[model samples]
Target: MHETVTVAHDDAAVVKMADLFDPEPATWGLRGDPYVWAALRKHLSGKDIPASLNEVLALLHAAFDELVGLDLVTEPASSVYREQYAHGGMSGGMIDLDAWRQRLIPLLTERARMRLEA
Candidate 1:
């Protein structure tokens, strides 16, 4: 007998989403969290999609966490976010997520710069 496993995020799905966020119009690349790739991969999991769009969205929301760890979203002509903010970033309780952002930003920036040069 053989153990079974599954793969996810077939080439077409990544290629399509990558196209949406590609850094260049004529070239292919991706922006946003590397975890997006991870999340996409996990969600695909080579299993068939469920029967509902809501189900899919819920999965995405769960797999991926916040970007800046706060309501980083901005809207023009409006100073308020209509949606109540939730910590996609936090699992336990209230913590200074913004402070963590301040600490991580510089380190990630340096790493990205090094990658660009390499």
Candidate 2:
């Protein structure tokens, strides 16, 4: 024979619901394979990012999606790149691949760090 048990909560606990569901923003962390950066860099070589923020974001999204579709990069990495581009800023202007490479170096480094840690 087996017995089942039930747990009960007091009304007072509900008062602290805010704490139970903390609103603090989580720290940003890389969430993908670092090697993806290398692949992206290679793919982007000699190409330029569009001057328009919208265009740049769209390009990145598409490129990342294709990489994921081809299994070249993990889905998580693509997701992280999407998030990064969204919050990167509104600044937009035609930038060569080298310039874009410099800008994304930090993100790539972080991704590498996360990969190492994992």
Tens digit of lDDT per residue, candidate 2, span 88-114?
333221112332233343343333333
Q: What are the per-residue Cα lDDT tens digits for candidate 1 across 33-82?
A: 33333334444455433334444344333433352233322212211121
Q: List the residue pairs that clash in candidate 2.
A: none
Cα-based TM-score, every candidate:
0.27, 0.34
- Tell me the spans in candidate 2 whose CA falls farther than 4 Å from its real position: 1-32, 70-118
| lDDT score, candidate 1, position 64 | 30
lDDT of each: 0.33, 0.37
The count of residue-pair clashes in candidate 1 stands at 0
Candidate 1 wrong stretches, greater than 4 Å:
1-35, 66-118
